[model samples]
Target: MVSVCRLVGLRAVARHAVLVIALGTGLLGAALVALGVVLIFATDVATVYFDWALVALGAATFGVSLLGVFGSKHESPPLLRAYASVLLLLLLSLIGAAAALSSLGEARIDAWMEEHWERIEATTLVVRKDQFEALLADHVAALLTLLACLVLVLTFDLLLVWVLQCSATSRHRRLRGEDVERKPLRASNGAGVELEAVAP
Candidate 1:
């Protein structure tokens, strides 16, 4: 009875969590698509590039969310695993990006400062070498902060992917009418009940 109750409770929680994640993904993808469409009409080439990037990301996210929804509903282990794998890759790439940004090249920093120096000079009443160095440091810090936010988001998404996989596994086993928690029985119950499970 305890096992049955625990299984039921877990399934209930997992089902709701999966639904929330699926819905969130769908909404976020849709928003990105909308943003891309808005940017597509811009005259600037940079905006055009950004639009395409957003569109591609939105499409991929939409497809992944579709797979997640379908797999959760149908209890497909392969689909769930695939989704998890992709999310894992995203997390890894975000980590790599953060690392790269933290170690950004001095040449690149110098070039950026060179480009912005005129603007900085015009805006400031006083400017010195130390002030320029401080500005460069601040810009680097800002970039790192942005990358950190992205990494956090990726980490959270990966966690949700893990939950989705577990939910799919649970549903699959339950659909097959397998016990949620089962231990193999031995010939006789002695001082030591050698425990083993035929887990899926």
Candidate 2:
């Protein structure tokens, strides 16, 4: 028979999941840092700088994962709040990125592609403008669609966890009678005081 402590509740599962996410995030961040180190030695200055930026972003993500893992495991309010705030910021940033991408309309995409067509054609001369455009369009669409799905899933999961945390906290507070809201009713003469019902 399984022990009582071995049987986990939804909250327990969520807490463990946070640690798992943290582990994965940390690994990804390490990989990015390694990649950035390699890229920094590349001959292309611009590409090296771009890789550095990715490394920075990866480091930030890794930090968030650490905070999330610690918060979830220890049930630390401050850490949990910080993790939630970071997720919110990431969600907003993703939305902004999506908007910016969408704003790069078809005309802009075509124009941008045309500007680089010479280099692209040098690699595959047989590719026609229309065909290349169509392929690029499809590729971009697929990427955006996948990213949108990911964002939606992340948003839902994070929101659910945050809500659950807040609800659990409030429930505990109420149980401890610390969540009682006392309403004061005083007479105009200030001779008497009335206490209204306290709602938790």
Give stretches of model 1 more than 4 Å off.
1-8, 42-48, 105-107, 110-143, 163-167, 170-200
Clashing pairs for predicted structure model 1, backbone only: none
C-alpha lDDT score of every prediction, in listed order: 0.68, 0.70
Q: Return model 2's CA RMSD, one decimal.
A: 8.9
| Lowest summed lDDT window (length 10), candidate 2 | 179-188
lDDT of 2 by residue, 74-181 (tens): 766677788888778888877887787789988898888879887666553455778878887878877778669758856864764585477557656775675345
TM-score attained by model 2: 0.63
Q: For model 1, state the Cα shift of residue 24 in Å.
A: 1.9
Best by lDDT: 2
